[model samples]
Structure formats: structure tokens, C-alpha cells
Target: MKTIISTKYIKNTVLAAAALFAVSATAQDADDTSSPFSLSGSIDTYFRTALTTSDADGTYAPEGASTSFANQTGFALGMANLIGTYEAGDTGVVVDLVFGPRGTEATFENDVLNGIINQAYAYWNVSDKTTLTVGRFNTFLGYEVIAPAANFNYSVSYLFSNGPFSHLGVKADFELSDDVSLMLGVMNPWDTNDISLTGEYSLGAQLGLYDQFFNFYYDSGRNGGLGFEVDYTGGFDLSDSFFLGINAAYNTNSETETGFYGAALYPQITASEDFAIGLRGEYFAYTADGFDDVPVIGLTLTGSYSKENLIIKPEIRLDSWGNDFEPFTDNDLAPSSSLATFAIAAIYSFD
Candidate 1:
């Protein structure tokens, strides 16, 4: 049978494959060391095939239904952090510099400059219970995150990272107890330009419990707006060799124009020390005053196997969005009512 493919998916697949290959080559030339100046990286690649249909196309069939061969891929590379000691070890200073290709860069036109520096930050350990960080850093919110497998759910939930990438400012984290902590910071809000907006700023705080089994974050900006997020995670052991877990989050912001909020539930079963299976379901919605609200719903089934130096994952996903947003069409404008997509992906990690 013949298969159809979308140009966008094809391009993404090729890029992902290239990133994976680069990571593999680099890892083979590296050595593991406990020295402060260490290096580590991982590569991910996947082929996404979709079967699309519309009423205008008559009977629903797989023929000519966009087959994305090797569509989505990427990689991440990071270096060992330096923790500087001061005053007879009474205070410690930590610095981290990280960069990566593919997803890390805003654009991937030329391979040479595609890997831009994504993170460069410093931290000061004020005490066992308090620490301060400055410079560019990832936001501390949500139960699921950009990190692979750290979240039971596959893909990204609207509540987890769709809003902003990083915050450039100062932050303080304080531990209230073994299971509770708090974080507060001030920075430019969302996608604001590096320069301050009329001396405007965004203030944020997070309350976390038990390594983030539950957490809440709030950000208030000078522009008469507020953003909030809540996350939760829980797991139970079914037997000696099997366990199940769930993760979920919700986010909302009041800028009054196209704000995002969503939730996800994942049920995972561990088959062994290095293998697992899971199902993920999520719903996300974006609302704006002058436009129709856009809602996206998706489901994914995933499986993985891993060992000392190799890890592999396979997943199938389906997504549908409300009419307000279009999907894969010539028009770049958001749709008005509905769109749907199906995809399959795989990844391999080595060190």
C-alpha cells in the first residue's frame, strides 16, 4: 500500500535523526569521570506516521494520509557544573553552562549555529536550607517537565512548559522542612524583551511538598496580570515487579489574550528494572477575549526498555484541537474549529 507524508513531519524527522547521530558519535569519544569538569549528552529520534481524514475527502481511509517518516527528533548536551567554595567552605558558589542542538535552539537553519547556549546560571548556597540563583534558569513549576521520563506522561502538557522557556533574574529557594520548600523570584514576564517594560517586572513564588508530589506556583506581573499553576504526582506498588503512577497539572494566566491551561493523567506499569508501559491522556485549552476558545485533547500509549548503556522508547499519539486552530494547513493563522493528528515516535539514548 502507498503511504502519504507531510512535508513538515518529514523535515522534523530528518532533523531529529541528525541530532541522534551527532550525539552517538560524541558519546563514543567521551570518557566517564568524577572530575568537576565533566560532559554528558543524549540523543532522541522518532518516525511519526499519521492517518488523516476529513468529510470533504469522503470515506475515511489511510491512503494518502500523511505518513511522517522519521519526523520528530532532538538531543541535549550539558557539561559538569562547577561549585566554587569560599571562606573555608562556609559558602559555596555553583555555576552551570548547558547547550544543545535541535529543540534547544530557536531555529535550526544551519547545523553549526543551531546549538545555542540555553542555560548559564550561578547559584549560592547560603545554608543547608537556603540557596540563591541568578541568571538564566528553567522555571520551577509543574509535575511534568521537559526532562524525559521524569514525567509519567509523554509529550508536554499545556500546564508544563508551554508558556515560557526561561527566566533571567534572581531567585531564592528555602526549605521549610524535610518535605516542604518555597521559592520566590522576580523576572521579566513571559516573552517580554530583555529590557524592562517601564520598569515592570514579574514576581513568582512556588510552594512545594515532598519532592514535588504536590506543588503550586504563582506569578504576578506589573501589567495587571497573574499566572498560576498546580501539579500533583502519586504512585502505588501493585506487586514486587509492577507499579503504577499518575501525574497531573493545571496552569492559567490572565493577560486576557490567548492564555493556556491543561491537565493530564498517566497510568504507568513497570515490568522490570529497565522496562515499562504506560498510557497518557491530556486536555488543553486556550482562551482569548476576541477569538473562539481553542481546546486540544490527546492520548498516547508508550513503552520502553533500557539497560546500562542503551535506552529505547516507542510511542503512539493522537491529538485533536478545537476549530479555533488549524493543523498543518497552508494558512499559518490559528484555526476556527477543529484539527486532528496522529503520530508515532521512538528514541534511543546512550552514554
Candidate 2:
């Protein structure tokens, strides 16, 4: 009787697994039908280490320092995006629903998933060269973005996040030629949850042109003034790989005017098909109108090797803000002309 019971339990487990596999296969086949819905999303993770030092022993202190010498580790899981597209001949509609982690939050209440509708919008393809989109959507402003591999610089730059993350309004996109495209939109100036300010709205425009080797973008928001950025990526056969990017923007508010700028350069040498070494350098500066025009600069040097989907990166960085800014007085760290940090990271991607 005991032997018979054990065999029955094993048989039930196998039957359950078979049932799940059949259901998954059926769902996949259903997706292959000419239905109007699709699902796609990506996940990204990174670890960072930040360090600071002062010229005087008591001048500066780290805000959130780890006790271990190892760099701080952070993990994030993004919600899988569900996209729906309906086409009734040439005229069609498309909608996107985006959900994901709300950054490095400590609790579930603050996660992006709490906002059920990350993105809800509609679009119409008026013609082969024109499209109109209305609702809440991501902005097309800078070169770097929330996407991981799309950016060579590890962390978010001051200009990228300071501009605009999303817009709630209407936008028109036109493809002028093979190499040129333009986008014009008017938005609520803030997130979807915020009410529009009286007599205040934000208008933005962007123009882009390039062939991958070189690209240029010009964008401006009513309140953020105008910004111009350019990127260049090209290299000779086996000599060297290089990339150079720069951006500048100026803004004026009722109380003050500010200027922001950034530049970065990366050069790599591929010693073998699976082995490479690279160096990255970046700088940022900010100046305020009425206050002392103090500037801040940050730099990073990295060495990386990649094999298929695996990547290993080791980096060192330094940050410094001009004397115009006040320093922290209560920590063991000291504020100096510059602070340095060292970190190593590994990543793996699967399909």
C-alpha cells in the first residue's frame, strides 16, 4: 500500500506539470493570431558606490555610507509592459501601458506598480509621414535615457532627469526626410497627478537627424529654455572605438536663471573578440543667476570585458562642487575639492 501511494503522488505531480505546459502553449498560439494585443518588457539592475572626502578632516561626511568595503547593491524588477495595437486596414490605434519599479524605494507602497496606469494613450497614423499621439507618454529629449544599454554613462546625468520625464497632453510627429524628424507637443508642465497651474502650460519641440554614426538633437520646453545636444560614435577597423557626446541648456525662472551643461568621451581597445578595455570621462557644470556662479564636475574611469551576455565592469569616479555650496559639518568625512569612489559591477542578460 505504501509503494502504491508514493507512485500515485509522483504521477499527480507529473500530470500537473503537463497541464501547465499545455496551457502556456495554447496561450502562445492565441497570441500568434491576428489579435490586437501584445506583451513586451525589459528588466535592468545596477550597483553603485558613492564616496566623498574633505580637504580638512572635519569638513565633510558621507550621507549614506555602507559599513562594508564592498559597494552598495540595489535590485529592481520592472513590470512587464502590455501593448495593444488595432489595425482596421490603414487606419489604426495603438496604446501602451507601462508599469515598473519606482526607483530604489524601501517599501512596496512607493513602487510604480501602485499606479495601475503607468501610461494610457492613443495614437493615429494620419499618413506615412505623420502621426498624432495624445495622453501621457515619455518625452523625447536627451541622448541618454532610463534604458540601460542605451546609455554609456552609468548613472543619470543632471540634464536628463532635470528636464522632463513625461508629458500629459498632445503631440504631433513628422518625418520630414530620411534623416530628419520633428516632434511638437504641449503638456501640463508636471506629472499627470498635478493640476495645471493657472495660465501656465508647457510647450516642447524636438528635431533629430543622423545615421547612427553621428546624431544631433535640439529640444526646448517653455520653462526650461532651449537645449542642444550631439553624439558621435565611430571607429576604424581594429584601432580604437570612440564616442563623444555633449549637451547644454539654459533656463530662466521668476526668481533666478540657471545654466546646465555636460560632456562625455569614451575610448576602448578590443584586444580580442571577447576581451576589451575602455576609459570614460565626463563633466557637468551648473550656474545660478543671483547666487555665486559655482560649478560642479564629476568624472569616471571604467574598464570592462564582455563575453556574449555577460559583462564585468570596474570603475572609479570623483565628484566635486565649487566653494559656493555649503559643506556638511557633522560627519567624519571632510569636504574637499574632490571626492573619489571605486566600484565593480557584473551583469547578465537572457533572451
Candidate 3:
């Protein structure tokens, strides 16, 4: 087989860090050859159709960079993931792998792929209330995760799509109390999984509060000299079967002086043990260097049905904006400033 390995940012950093960590750990670590390990993951597929006739594929306008999960006109494979975790004493390791268009496109930073690794990290429990970790890992900025099985809606929000998906670096997590904790780290530049080859490094931190019925998480980071962002997320359980979640974010770049601010609300109701419904209402706007602020509103409704380890999600979404922007659809067919789409997805998970 033919293969290529690029000297991208993250690859070099990951290799050097992993080697150093291994050497330091091996000297003081005790063997746990008898310890147990486990494997688990999920597979997902979907069909989507845009309601607009502006494009042959009925592709929705304003679906921009983030809604590509179900952009295909017909049946499409979303992703296949496999996760392996092993823990023995104070040391642990995790390896997550994924494949599919959504998987590749989302993390193809620097246009490099090696076994489609989503996260490969190792950690040591410094103490009962503290831990230190290194390698690639998911970001703590958003309420929605990279896994489809974990999200109520199949389509991703603009905040999640546009924000950093993962980080490559070292971090320390501290549990301060029963309801509060803190995470601090230094990492590669924002939105890039590998090192950026630049000497500049980003700083990251997350403060979290988790209680019985309410949870709040806030994340902030500066992308070296380029920009900075703040993301806040909160969740509340109003009743046994009803819940609400909110997310807001603001990001600004130093060079351009442009900024983006957005907010989203997620409300869900459980109709039964096997059926549920949810809605997401969101508003997003951006200010450019020379142009006035432009904004849009999006609404999404989704239903989920579960049977054993299999789950099916059906969703419909609409987006509306002002005439200050170009018509959402291609060829300017949908000049009315709105577009719509519907999609259905099936997911199966196992251990």
C-alpha cells in the first residue's frame, strides 16, 4: 500500500509529547498486565432532502459549513466509530477512531489523516481529586459533542461547527468541590488538532458547576495573537420528562477586528420511554471589517425513537435572514430570504 505522512502541526507535537511521557511514566509505573480493558462505539447513517427547488439536490441555503452532516440528497453514511479504553492503577489510555465523510471533513486539519483518529490520549491520576493528561481530546466548549448518539439532534449547531472541535496539548483537571471543578491547559492554536508549527501557543480554561437538576459550564481560550473566544452553556431539568439547554458564544480576532456572537436554546420533552421530541432555536450574527452586522435565525425540530441499541432521528430545520445578504439558495432562486430541509437518521451503538 502507498501512504504519505505530512509534517503538519499536530503530528510532530503528539509524537514528541507521547514519547517523553512514556519514558517518564515507565520508570515509576507498575505493571498491570492483568487489568481489564473495553471497546465500544457507534455507527450512523442518514437521508436528507432540502425543501427548496432552487438546487437540483434540493440543498438548503444558509446550511453553510456546519450543517454538512446530512448534505447529501439521498442515503449517506454518517460515521463509524470505535473507542478503546484501558485503566490500571493510576494510569489510563483512550483511543477513539472514526470514519465517514463527516468524520474526515470535521477533523481533516492541515488535510492530514492517520487511522482517522479522533482522540488518542493518556492520563495519570496524580491524586484522587487531580489528574494530568496529554494528547488529543474533545473540547469542553459546547453542549453538543462529536458523537451523534450523544446529541438529541442529528444536525450540529453553528456554534459547534464553527468552534474548536478538539485540542492537542497538556492539561490539568482539578476537582475543587462536589459542585465545582476547574480545567486549565496550554494547547495548539484554536481549531487545529495538530501543532501549527508556529511558536505561539493558546491558553484554555473551563469552570464547571454540576448539581442535581442544573448544570453550567464555561470555557474560554485565546488563540495566541490571532483571536480569543468565550463560550457559556447551561442546562436545566424542568420536569421528569422536560429539559432545557442554552448556549451563547462570542469570538473576536485581533487582526481583523471582526467578531461573531450567537445564542441557541434547546428544549426537549420525553413523550415515552422510547419516543421523544426536541427543538432548537438559534440566532447568529457576525460583523465584518467593512460591513455592518449580518444575522440569521434558525429553527429545528427533531423526534427520536429508540429500540434496544438502535435509535432513529427525524429532523426538520428552517433558516431565515435579511435581504442584506445574498439569497440563500444557489442561482438566487430563493430570494425570499428563507430555506428549509428535512432529514432522517439511524444510529446503532454497542460495546
Candidate 4:
């Protein structure tokens, strides 16, 4: 929380801007354009608690959490998301905005900009197989998204938490055939909301074959940067009610000799029209020259129920670092290798 950029003054400014955008999305477009403009978004909240006992003063109940978001104990608010789009002919503009704890973490610049804009971009269809996009957009390197309603599991994976969340750049997408596609771009570093003080840049690319994708990112800098990464993310439907999701990534900086590698599997089953269950199992590690590798494994079980626009998810998770590391404290407040926690979240979407 110490790193958060929000303050009382900044918060009020964001709220006012959101209200103005909402009104324009609903009322102003009618007189301005012949193309239909659209608006949509979602809201989420949750309550989480560690199943294990903590230190005497309870200073670190969820410090053992290996990923990001939904880590805070007790009741918490996720975020309020809003998206507005205007399309005409083969070109369009999109404005996505978010507010609250989750939004603050994702953009990392809403407070500085005096608004909650997460992505503001425009796209043009140059041909049947080629298109161009400019400005900020979510990262293309991961399976999970920042939107809570779009993901089956409420919490994200360590790979997702460590990898870039968004990019500020211009990208071109190409469709070579029915099953093959590609993307390439140059950007202002990974997860960067504003161009760096040094005016540095990065490279990004993705190759897609059917449902699978291979993503790559490269930055030349060594300090305070993500030097390089390659990722594979995809999923398959095995049966009418069974599905499998896969994600893996490796990151390393040759100049700095520091890196990490991780992989995760998701298996899910639909039990009924309103109920479904899923599990995520992941193995993650950190590595450096002249140092031993530190590895950890995590497993999560979640059940989801939905009716119309409302979805409810209940989850249980555990993380353990083997003999290589003892990152948690047990019931007796002594060093241990594992921790357990539980949470339930509610999400509502509107269009």
C-alpha cells in the first residue's frame, strides 16, 4: 500500500472525470455521430482471510500470498470498470477506465493523470487481414486479464503478476490465414504508463497458431527493467464440459544475470447452467548467477455460480516453498514452508 499513488485530492479529480465521461457516452454521441457508440463495464468485491494462524501481532497474515490482487485480508473492494467505444466505418476509438484498488495497481498512473483511464486508443482496418492500433493497451503476453469478470479464477498467477501488465505503443496485427496470425510493435518499456525519463524503448512480438500464442519482449537496459521474456499461453476444450488452460514464461537479463521461469495449468469443468468448478496449479522459480534457485508451487480451487449479470466465486488456495525456501510462518508463528487461505468474490457486469 505504501507504493500506491492515490491521495484524497487525486481521488476526487478522478470521480469528476468519470462522471463527465459517463454522461458523454450516454448522451453526447447521439448528436455527434451516425455510428452507434457503446458503453460497458463491471464491478467486483471480495472478502478474504488466511486459514492459518499468523505472528503474535498478526503483522503478516497474507504476506505469504505469492501472486497479486485479492491478497488483502477482511472485506475489500476490487474496482469499478467502465468502457466507452465509438466506431465508424472500419475505424474506431476505445476509452477504458477503472477505479479502486485493482485499477490503481493496473494503470499505476491514474493519479498522476488526474483520471482513471486504463486504455485510450484508436484502431484502423487497413484491409481484410491487416489492422493498426495506437496508444495504450493491455499486455498480450498472458492468459489472464485485469478484468475480474473475464477470468474464472479470482486471483492471478505468479507468472501474470511478474510479467508486464500493459504497453504504451503502436502495434500492427496481421491475419495470414484462417488459423495463423501475428503482431509486432515497439513500445515505451513494459508495464510503463509514461515514457521513461531516459526516453527508453522496448520491442514486442507475438505469433499465433490456432489457439496457441508465442509472445516475446525485449529491452536493452539492465537496471530497473525487464530485459527479456518469452511466453506461451493458450487453452483447449477437451469435451462439452471440460476445458484445459496452459501458460508458461521465462524471463532473463543477460546483462544483469537475473531471471525467473514459471508454468501453470488450469483444468475446469462445468457442472450445470449456473455452476462450474476449476483448479489452477503452478510452479514458479527465481534464478541468478552465483546463487541457488528459489522455487515455489501453488494450487487453487474455485467454484463459480452465476445468474444473468451476477457471478459469485468461492476459492481456497495454498502456496508452498519446498526446502529451498521457508517463506511462511505456521500456526505457531514459526518458520514454515506453506500457507492456506480462502476467499469469496462477487462480480456484476453491465452493458
**Predicted model with the maximum TM-score:** 4
The residue-by-residue lDDT of candidate 2 on 81-183, one tens digit each, is 3334444544444444334442221111222546544344566777888877777655455434433323344444445544444556777777788866666
Rank by TM-score (best first) = 4, 3, 1, 2
Model 2 off-target regions past 4 Å? 1-36, 51-119, 190-199, 211-240, 265-280, 303-313, 324-332, 345-351
- Residue range 138-196, candidate 3, lDDT tens digits: 77666666777777888877777767777888888777887777778888777668666
lDDT of 1 by residue, 100-206 (tens): 33244221222243434333455676788887766655545443433342333334444454545456677887778876777777777653424455555666676
Per-model TM-score on C-alpha atoms: 0.65, 0.63, 0.83, 0.86
- Candidate 3's clash total is 3
- Candidate 4, residues 1-351: lDDT per residue as tens digits? 011111111211112222222323444554664445767788999988778757443223334335767767788899898888777788877788889888888887543565477878788888888888888877777777777777778988888887877777888888888878888888886676666565778898888887678889997543655499999887777877888888899999776688889999888888888888899899998788889877878898999888887889999988877645776677787877777888999999876
Native-to-model Cα distance after best TM-score fit, residue 95 in candidate 1, in Å: 6.8
Better of 3 and 4 by TM-score: 4
Candidate number with greatest lDDT: 4
Instruction: Give each model's whole-structure lDDT.
Output: 0.46, 0.44, 0.69, 0.74
List the candidate 1 regions with Cα displacement exceeding 4 Å.
1-34, 53-101, 105-115, 149-154, 191-198, 213-255, 290-292, 322-351
Overlapping backbone residue pairs in candidate 1 total 14
Better of 1 and 2 by lDDT: 1
lDDT for 116 in candidate 3 is: 80
Give residue 89's error in model 2 in angstroms. 5.8
